[model samples]
Target: MKIKGLKQLSRTLEKAGQSGFRTEAAKWLEQTGTDFLDLVRDEIVRAGSIDTGSLLRSFKRGAEGNIWEIEKGGLTLEVGTELEYASFVNDGHWTGGKEEVRWIPGQWHSGRFQYDPGSSSGMVLKRQWVKGTGYWEHAFYIFERLFEKRLNERLQTWLNSL
Candidate 1:
């Protein structure tokens, strides 16, 4: 007896096992990244940090903002914002250096704080430090759990298909 179509069988198996797996994994990664982005936004909302919606919009996937790279059988996903004040909002900061109380030159209009150096009306903040909301941190913690569960399910499904 002679083996026939062994080369063809090998090629087919390679394509289905390797390339197919990579394709499926990439899809799952992209979906997870999108979900993670939404989670971060939700966390920010939960933290009551939505002021101008700029920071929220900054958390996107693509070359313009967040990092989303899937190449050469490798995957990389990062969700972040370019807004400078995002970190300040996520992490607490001192209102003023070595000052117990500081007068901020901002006016409150429509229940929103607006900074105006020339504004005569201002409010004094007596707190030395503002508490961090930790929205990003909380989002990451949630993502970790979600990612593990999703990965396991995807892998199991993929293996079953094979």
Candidate 2:
């Protein structure tokens, strides 16, 4: 989108802070980020698949200096964590079987022992291949439409003031 009075805005931003280009870009990025996050949350919530409320509640949308990031949960993935599962839900996961094993906590005077899942021999974990729903794609499509429509007006208004 063409932002009117960009040069003027840049100069003003630099005077107010540091890098004007970065500052101006951050404003637009934040606006789009908010829209993206909201639309994505709405889509996921309406789909009623995973816990959209929790996912959306932890959604992150903002810029770090010149970089803009939109993330659903933690920045990094940790095994056995909600964020890991959320990643699987968003992109789907491959079905594979590994020898299943677990440890039973000590009880009374007994010590913990390695437990094999399924019968005496070993059991293969069931595989469930889930197809990706392209949840993010749907949200991006909605966000694009919204930003395309509103960006010009917002930029024009901001420019006028500048």
Candidate 3:
């Protein structure tokens, strides 16, 4: 008995391994990043966290003046946000002094909190904590599962083509 088509198989494998595989993988990774960003924006909207649409717009591609950044390279993907208040919105925070009662210089308009130092209207509270909306956290939780499933499907399709 003799083995046949080994040469063709080897050549195909080599070609795939050189650059084709990397290019395909990078494409899928970039797509996944885009999908993840859309998912996060949808989650923010679903959670009713849109105030001025700043956070929603921040989750996008590119680097200049954007809070969120999505970078893709050879078989690597990176997703992050530069907004400092994002964590606070997702994790919650205290309103004023936790140890002592303090006067908070802010005003409530139509059930929304607005910080105004010059405004005469204000509120006093102690150890008051605002619950986190968990929009980002929820989006991440959802995107984790989605990314795994999508990556597997994409890889399977690529491999089948090979």
Candidate 4:
């Protein structure tokens, strides 16, 4: 994920320095939030898949100035997407939730045109039972695993930089 508006973040940190405790807290939170997003994006790309690029692109950091204010970052670090189908890519269908059954109406045209036996033309009702196996391919979970392995080294580097 490409994080935008760091020039503004610098100004935010400066303002936070002047505002005392609350702003200082905001500054720390913003840093951690942005870093976490970057880490997730890196992990997603490294994991690599057909939809991984789009998924990485979907991860966004709040605008820099907004990072220090309640309207955007501050206590509200928003790092997600407007992409409607993100859930489908993250979690394979029917795997994220419990099993379900859907009842579909019987129709003549649907039966004759769509099926070979055309046995569904009967007036009797039909139910489709969807069994969910919990086939989880969620990239974030992979990222979590990678982060766990690297956490100590990553934290050590960041602390040394400070």
Off by over 4 Å in 2: 1-25, 60-82, 98-125
**Which candidate should be chosen as best, given TM-score against the real structure?**
3
Write one digit per residue (lDDT tens) for candidate 1, span 1-162: 768988877776776787577778778888888888889889998999888787777676753445455453676655576677788899988775675787778789999999999888898877567888999999999999888888999887876576
For each predicted model, how many residue pairs clash, with residues at least 3 apart or on different chains?
Answer: 0, 0, 0, 0
lDDT to native, each model: 0.79, 0.55, 0.75, 0.49
Q: Which pairs of residues clash in candidate 3, taking residues 3 or more apart in a chain or in different chains? A: none
- Model 3: CA > 4 A from native: 1-12, 63-74, 99-127
- Residue 49 of model 3, lDDT score: 77
The superposed Cα distance between candidate 4 and the true structure at residue 46, in angstroms, equals 2.7
Relative to the true structure, candidate 4 reaches a TM of 0.39
User: 63-159 in candidate 2: lDDT tens per residue?
Assistant: 1111234332333221111344556666777666454443333322255344544435432346567776566677778867787678778656655
- Location of the lowest summed lDDT over 10 successive residues in candidate 1: 63-72
Tens digits of per-residue lDDT for model 4 on 1-162? 766978776766565556554544455556655655566566556545335355565554543222222333346645555556554544434423244443334455734633334454534333433332221244345546765556566544543433
Candidate 2's TM-score reads: 0.51
Better of 3 and 4 by TM-score: 3
Superposition-based RMSD of candidate 4 using all C-alpha atoms, in angstroms: 12.5
> Candidate 4 — which residues are off by over 4 angstroms?
1-19, 50-52, 62-74, 94-162
Q: TM-score for model 3?
A: 0.70
Cα RMSD for candidates in order: 6.5, 10.5, 4.8, 12.5
Q: Rank the candidates by TM-score, best first.
A: 3, 1, 2, 4
